[model samples]
Target: MDKKYSNKGLKIIAAEIQGSSKQAIGKIIEENNVGFTVTKGAQGPVSIAGIPHAVAFGADGKLIFKGHPASEEFKDVVREALRDVKVVKENLGGLVALGDVIEQRTWTNSEGVKMVAAVTKIDVDKVVFRLQKNGKIVPYPISKLSEEDQKLIKGMIEDE
Candidate 1:
């Protein structure tokens, strides 16, 4: 497999096609003259919500496509199938709605005092943390903390 597309962590979905539907997909592949292989397996859960199945399409034994229900290259086919369905616009901002408090523990320089903090706001470069006791907001530079400390802090916050 080509290293370029053979990401170990990449997710894939596989499905078995039979009858007329299989013939249609096969015709498309044959028309395109792209090499591919099919394998048999039990259906499994999909990482993407809307997608239900995933498969791998390889050319010359190298993976070129991956995703659920449709190979990456054939995603448009799946999209067209779902075109008629009305999809509700999800409020991305509402995913972590305000007042949905997540308790996090932090270490204070004043001593190694473990303090509870609330995640008020999170951004790419900085995080807004407020002391749970008095609600005092403090900003922490993400670069300042070591990876281990970050994990520790994250674990403490999620523990509660």
Candidate 2:
């Protein structure tokens, strides 16, 4: 699936939250030749009631599907979501092109705490951070961020 949709901008991340040891997980990944990122944590904002559950997020960072991966509906939803997605080259560092989707990013605050989130909404004095950890939307004053972060936000706003 990764090879099939990678060029179409489908990013898959598997979060292993069953408390498996890192070494054991590494061995399993090596043994199976898994190709995507597998983090050891709970998926933020998504609730899974059982194993093999799947969730799909569209290019706009919106939840679009939740169900078993083997279900037919999952594939249909994924295909539809990628229908208008622009291809993105992996690991190439540059600004997102006009009409390109904004993926998750790391942000730091004035106290030096950091989190991985996407900028959901940016107001004049505040920004909404959608945390990838617990699926929480945090409202933060733009002034409380580090100088570098503030500049980053400014750049994003300028691009708009």
Whose lDDT is greatest here?
A: 2
For residues 45-151, write the lDDT of model 2, one tens digit per residue: 98897887889987667899998888899999998887876665454343343243335678788999998877677889998877789978788899999999898
TM-score of each: 0.27, 0.55
- Candidate 1 structure quality by residue, lDDT tens digits, 51-114: 3445343322333334554345456543443344332213212222233233345544323445
Global lDDT of model 1: 0.45
Task: List residue ranges in candidate 1 displaced over 4 A.
Answer: 1-101, 107-114, 152-160
Q: Considering summed lDDT, which 10 consecutive residues are worst modelled in model 2?
A: 92-101
lDDT for each of the candidates?
0.45, 0.78
Candidate 2: residue 83 Cα off by (Å): 1.3
What clash pairs does model 1 have?
A: 13-54, 13-55, 14-54, 53-68, 53-69, 104-157
Residue-pair clashes per candidate, as listed? 6, 2
